[model samples]
Target: MLSLPRSRSLLAAAAIVATVATAGSLTYSLGLGLTPCELCWYQRILMYPLVAVLAYAYYTADTGIYRLVLPFCVGGAALAAYQSYLQVVAGGTCTFGGCAAVYIRPVTIPNQSLIAFCLIGLCTLGLAVRTRRDRT
Candidate 1:
């Protein structure tokens, strides 16, 4: 059975991932001189808060934070996935920053964002499932 501490550990890991992702995004924009597109900004809006929310969850051992985090995850993931489709598959374009621009080589910013959101979302989901399973 998954223990609370283990579940909380997952949240902590999620927090760490969020922190790194947020930092990476900032580095791209503020440090590397890469401007974000509209979609990127939306992903950032959803992602930036997870650092705080997941950190709080880790500190308080508040497993319920998943309720708040998952929605953001879903939204961010959806946007990232769509943007990725635009950049890689559908060949869509954005007025700002060029949605198809591949800054990281092989993966676009939206793809990177998608990966981060998915990781955090999986952690949050794991925390939720393990907590529930333990209760039963």
Candidate 2:
């Protein structure tokens, strides 16, 4: 198997997640004709860049990129969490508009928010592990 080094692998994972997330959101809006609300747009803004950031970091094998990516991840996570909260407590009723899912009801939550949660986990892992060594 062609395997990347640890740091690159982490970046690759994050990149994959962000890519999938961006594609899914785009599909929801463009293919299914589902519109994204203001909060969803905010989360999208945070997510789309992660795809580029992680991909470039992985390609360059930039060990320092994980920390740089943390802010976006954390922001996405917060938005996802708040979105989830709104779904549960407030019934996803946005002041600007409302949010909806593509699927019928196997799951009652928004899939994009779930992706954000997963992205949050991947980013946390990226930051928690020491993908590089300190120069003495």
Candidate 3:
């Protein structure tokens, strides 16, 4: 009956998201043979940092660092959500060539990556909110 701390939960969630994202990228590169575009690269740049940041925050028990990291997670999530919609729902009509080309043909979307990132953001946000409530 041991209760885990919020920071630990958030860190675990971020790690899971990072793991899934890495796997998806590998799958696309090795299995689907799809190359990522500039926007996709940018999204990855923003996302990869969260794994480290959240891990550090959890290790240090620094809710303040978590607060800072949350914005980046949210931004990455927003980008991923938009890309997923464009690729899956919109049928790859997005202006980005990589998104349209890779996703348009089979209507394939990186839904797992999108969901993982969004969940990371949401869980971190929830943790941050709860932390703030406890402090106040």
- The Cα error of candidate 3 at residue 81, in Å, is 3.0
Q: Write the per-residue lDDT of candidate 3 for residues 1-136, one digit (tens) a residue.
A: 2124856776677667776676677677678787776667767787777777777766776666656766776777777777777765665555575654454233444455566667787777777676777776
Best by TM-score: 1
Taking all chains together, each candidate's TM-score versus the true structure is 0.91, 0.80, 0.74
TM-score of 1: 0.91
Flag the better candidate by TM-score, 1 or 2: 1
| Candidate 2: worst-modelled 10 consecutive residues by lDDT | 127-136
Q: How well does candidate 3 score on lDDT at residue 37?
A: 62
Indicate the TM-score of model 2: 0.80
Q: Pick the candidate with the highest lDDT.
A: 1
lDDT against the true structure, per candidate, is 0.87, 0.68, 0.67
What is candidate 3's TM-score against the reference?
Answer: 0.74
Error of 3 at 129 (Å): 1.4
Number of the candidate with higher lDDT, 1 or 2: 1
Cα distance off (Å), candidate 2, residue 38: 0.6
Per-candidate RMSD vs. true structure?
1.8, 3.7, 3.8
Alpha carbon lDDT at 107, candidate 2? 49
- Poorly placed runs, candidate 2 (over 4 Å): 1-4, 92-96, 100-105, 108-111, 120-124, 132-136
